[model samples]
Target: MNATVIIPAYDPEENLQRIVDRVWDLGNHVIVVDDGSDISKSDIFHRLSEKAIVIHHEKNEGKGAAIKTALKYIKENLWDCNVIGVMDADGQHLPEDMEKLVMKANNRENAMILGVRSIGEDMPLKSRLGNAITRFVFHSLSGVKVSDTQTGLRAFSYKLIDKLLQVEGTRYEYETNVLFYCAKTEVPIIEVPIKTIYHDKENSCSHFHAIRDSYRIYRDILKFSLSSFSSFILDYVLFCILTVLFPAGGVGILFANILARMISGGYNYFMNCRFVFQTGTKTQTALQYLTLAICILVMNSIFLQIYAGIFQIPVYMAKVLTEISLFVISFFVQKKIIFRHKVSGRGMIKE
Candidate 1:
């Protein structure tokens, strides 16, 4: 299978050696990145050097950097390697599980394989709670549902190395961004059920700062959501105000709807470029956004007609339904089309 296993170790212990030895025994090459662990942990890496290619950083970088380091090494040196595996060094992942992921990668045409764990009572409480709270980050932003958004155990073909390196994130958020990258690029994610092994149930060795790193992963989407919500409030409130001022009927409602959208859409476009998506107001991007806005406006009018004109529902209730229905579609369109990222040849995000 010509697979290479990459383990990013920070103050790892006996299990690191065990995983390396077992992977080597299974006939897979291993690359161990010493992510600036203390001098006390040097010996473990030294011993691993005999069984694997050991790369050390003088200072601590994050897990994302370590994985990129190993990927770069593979892309430069090991051209024959067809499959690449990445796993945590804290002993939560079993070598057999890694083998399953690698095997799955080999069979898949163009997809990243995830060794997804069952999040339940058997797992850490923080992990369980985090997954429960944060799966929305994936489904809401990318319009893709991933069972394990933060699983460290992942395998992909050498072909995806460039795109993965291009994904932005340095620490824990890197894993989350990788999933987003795959979703963006139309790379399928194949999840394989793996054993959920938590070596220490309480106070685990994971370096994931739950609150801090989670914010990094969710920050962009959170800001965009707030921007969208604020824009909707402006749109709806102004629609109501204009309707009252005219106080006509269906005709007044239509006029108010268009007027409110023009105001709120302008605010949304500004906020998305300046604050939410962080994109420049290039002409092409502006044109694309305008097209989307027009399409959404038409869709909004149709929904309002169905709700208010035909069904005789209150215009107020119809406005809420129309906005809610379009939220996900509008967000995804703006993200995928209007605010797309550029990828460099060596896998860096240019903007």
Candidate 2:
């Protein structure tokens, strides 16, 4: 695969040597980014510098920054390297599992590979719950169903590296940022099984404060959720205004509803295009969204009329019932059709 393994180390006290040895055994070049670790204390990392191309950051730049540096070096060198794998410096990431990821990356040179941890067995309670929350956030915000959104054992093709380098976050939340970027660029993600080996004695781990880091990840995906809420509010407020102005039985009702939907839909399109997806807007993007909105409106109106007229349900209650049904179609249309962000990185969403 002509692959290169990039490991970003920051005050790494775990089994870094073993990881280095294993990457070498796999017959892949290694790039260790020492993220401002004290040279005196990190003697082992210093020694391994001889075996791999070491990029030292005098200041402790975050993992995202370290990756950005390594990616630049790889691109500048013009390495024939097709696959790039990354994992933790801690002994948690097994050498054998990494090989499995590399093999998968070799076969699917165009996909992003994720090493999914089988945390179902012997997992810490805090770790499990934290991962669950992150997983929910990922699916809700990105429309991508992923379980272990925070797993460190990941691999990506060269094409993905080019895109990943453009991501903005420079901390532990960088992985979360990558997920959003991949979604935007249509990166294929698949997950392979992995084992969690937590050998931290005092658990005085890196600066990855779970609460603080999780908040950052949440913030990164907030744009999508916020955009959706904005659209919902716009639709609801406008619908109310139209209903009051036109009254239910007037001919003006249909036109008012349709116009209100278009107004709200426009707000959603612009927000999702610029903030959520962060991609260049296609000429037909707006038309596609409008079409979807029209379909939703028709479905909603039909359901409402049937329920309110035939079933004798209250008008407001019928509207609510219809809106609930529309949720499924709206989600499917946005995920599978309209905002069809293809996953490039290979990984399964697990919790």
**In model 1, which range of ten residues has the least summed lDDT?**
342-351
lDDT per residue as tens, model 2, 1-351: 687888888887747877888888878888989989886647877778867888899998888899889999999894698888887776778877888888888787666678887656466666777788888877765667776787889887877777788888888888888877666566667788888786553334545777777777787356656776677778777877887888566355565557777887788788877876665478666678778888887876677678877898875576567666776566556655666666434334331
Per-residue lDDT tens digits of candidate 1, residues 181-222? 777667777888888678677637888887788888888888
**lDDT of each structure?**
0.86, 0.75
Query: Clash number for every model?
Result: 0, 19
Off by over 4 Å in 1: 229-264, 278-351
TM-score for model 1?
A: 0.76
Lowest lDDT block of 10, candidate 2? 342-351
After superposition, the stretches of candidate 2 with alpha carbons farther than 4 Å from their true spots are 1-3, 21-28, 36-50, 58-60, 78-83, 103-108, 130-149, 156-169, 172-192, 200-221, 240-244, 247-259, 279-283, 302-328, 342-351
Compared with the true structure, the alpha-carbon lDDT of candidate 2 equals: 0.75
